[model samples]
Target: MRQNTTPRGLVQAALAMTLVGTLTAVSAAIARYPVYGGQAVRYAVAAVILLAVARFGDRSRASRPRPRLTVREWSLVAALAATGLAGFNVCVVEGTRYTTPAMIGTVVGAVPVLLAVVAPLMERRRPAPRLVVAAMIVTLGATAANGLGGGSLQGLLLALGALAGEMAFSLLAVPLLPKLGPMRVSAYSAAAATPMLLVVGLLVDGTAVVRIPTAGEAAGFAYLVIVVTVGAFLLWYDALGRIGADRAGLFAGLIPVSAVATTMVLGLGRPSAAELVGALLVGCGVAAGLGRRVRRPAPVIAVTPGRESVRVAEASRP
Candidate 1:
């Protein structure tokens, strides 16, 4: 079934994700300074910011004006938050330890592809052939950009897992949109995931959390909280709500392209001609695939608050 699609909202969401990816890559570079895990540091910081927002952003909603969730709904939301938000963050950070930032970014870029596959599976449908092709091209480009020569097996593995984490997040989050609005969904997810992450961070990093970070690390942590965590989540869920999860995911492929470019611009490293070509091809391929949006019928559930979920639209899938 097709849905009432919103082009402008989708574009804005894509732009937000792209910005998050770029900023995340740069922050990773900055995190390299303190010998603490950039991924862990950024996430821990992000959790704090998210909690603050969740607490203070909407005091009216704080008491939960909506009806209380059934036990099942709470469990589902917790699982979704744990795997999608929490799991993705942890894996990406841990993956960076074993992989190059470029490699991590590239693999992370493939999240759209993963979402394409996973979304269809969740909906009990088959994905389009063009999406499959786009995903493959993006994968090949990611492999090339990550210096896929020899002796990089560990990085490759970690990168792949990171991609999986991202896809898992996207797939799990889609169904939750209609149940919990984007703000509450994200806030609750982040808040729920915070405790577990804190425990993990304490166990893994030890006293590092209390230790003062260098100027650069502090800046990186702040950027991650402001940009990647807060900005990215808002845009991501907003996109999911506007378009179906599948189309929204298509734009995710731009992440690695942005990350690699950002890295090169910062003089950390330059992509070889081959890598550059790969990045562009991946970016273009994903965009081209997404550009083929066919108007479809609206979902059975109302995504917007106080509005009916179903809408009159065409009869093709994304």
Candidate 2:
């Protein structure tokens, strides 16, 4: 059994969270283009990268042990890939096509809030009242930040669907994290998304991703698939393993902040003062919910031959 955790774990977790946030922001930027095929593109790239990594780094199946997920677990993985990869892509892409990329960014930014509210439900755990209050506050902020309550009701609804799909991905993926190592899970998840992407690509792009994609576009797609999807998962899972799920989850709140920062750097969309404030509120809510009090492990009391040793229980925040 592992005896101790270290500072490296925390560093890895922070880096992973930041990278995920950056990549998501990048995805938002280039969301135009026939990238209507994000699910396929993401999976195709991810499969290639991960299959390579698995082969080179740890090809010994016996040493590592072959995955032994039950049928239910496999089903959950499929559902996670479909909802997180396919559903989010399809909804966000369609929403972008119908409305604007800026709007999509704003909508997607609300994912942390959705995850915060949905997490307890997935774990079959009752949430503290603070979590509920935080979620409500964040929801209100997101509504205002996205201008979702204003015009473009159709696009807003589509964005909401995308958020729901993402929440499903987060909740569904939780149980699988313990069984499938994060890298393996990501590889399989991407593999699961391949067929869906292929089907959509044939119908939408028609061999165009290879034929028409500029070098930069291809690079972007590759980055999304291999680096963002695969690398991000590996780092994220490592962090989650070291820190408990709740603490690991709080980092996700940084995604929208990263998105807005990227947008500002690109000079694409100038986030309004109100939008910034809204993002802050939403982020605060997400962190608050994910910060549900961590119950520390009880201390061990040692009994000597003639005496009992009193050990004080120490609470450690994950």
Candidate 3:
């Protein structure tokens, strides 16, 4: 595990929150357009942008031989594309059709809890007590923050589907990190998922797949493509490399808070007192869960050419 805190890691966390924040705003566009078609367009745009960057943006990367994935790695990448990109978008878009974005956001806040449970099982170890407690606290806070809002049974079930997709996507990607690095993993996953989404969109949305989006819808779709899909995924994977998935997952607790703030900004409504209280609990729980006591490094002894060895203290963890 990475022992030191990093500015990049913090930025990744912020980007993750930003990604979630975009979901509510993007829901407006999804509502305006066909769900599968909108998603297909967004992913296709993002895939093209990412692939272009990967292939020709930097001279050194362009010159290096492209990284080849083993059959197993390729299989994992396919799974990541399916569950994380295509499946997640489809589920979220469909779920939002029957439920409010706030409710969906609240449901997604369970991701950290799912990760806390699954990460230990994947590693063949018992779950940490503190992590378990933190997960529970986060869940409670998320539920309260959303006021336990009611939605249709189908909507709730679909929201759960999205949750499952998200959990699977995250867990599956962890094992592939060493082979493909974050950007390649994200770029390839997006590219792989684009064709799948296009096929699905054609089948489900019919000729609506070819419809052009309005100015507002286009703006929302662009944000979803550039900021949420590409930028957020890259930042998330990068942070996962630095902090390990378990700790990085806990940052998901911020999603509901961001969603609520986004809602208010859109003039939806102010947060209720309970929601404010819940947001505070979420903040505290996330801090407690992620907090670690850094171990001091052993002092190093330097050997000078003609002098006695000198002891020097190493830099502390940030």
- What's the lDDT for all of these models? 0.66, 0.65, 0.76
Model 1, span 1-318: residue lDDT tens: 233356766676678767865874566646444332454445556656665665675574666655457788788778876777667666766766676666676657666667667787777989877776776676666656554432267777866777776776666667667766565666667667766666666777676634566787687777776787777887778777777666677666666566678887888787688778767776776676666555567544335668766654444344
- Give the per-residue lDDT of model 3 (tens digit) for 1-318: 342357678668657766766586557765768777777777778878877776774555656677788899899889888888788878777887788766776787788788888887887888777777887787778777766566798889878888887887678887877667677778888878878888888888777775877888888887888888888888888787776666677777777777778888888889889889878988887777777745677665566788886767675544
Model 1 lDDT-worst window of ten: 31-40
Top candidate on TM-score is 3
For candidate 3, report its TM-score: 0.84
Candidate with better lDDT, 1 vs 3: 3
Residue 5 of model 1 has an lDDT of: 52
Full ranking by lDDT: 3, 1, 2
Worst 10 residues of 2 by lDDT: 1-10
Instruction: Encode model 2's per-residue lDDT on 58-102: one tens digit a residue.
Output: 666648766688999989878977777787777876786567655
Candidate 1 regions with alpha-carbon error over 4 angstroms: 1-5, 28-64, 96-109, 149-158, 267-269, 293-318
lDDT of 2 at 82: 77
Clashes per prediction? 7, 0, 0
**Candidate 2 clash pair list:** none
Model 2 earns a TM-score of: 0.74
Cα-based TM-score, every candidate: 0.75, 0.74, 0.84
Worst lDDT run of 10 residues, candidate 3, spans 1-10
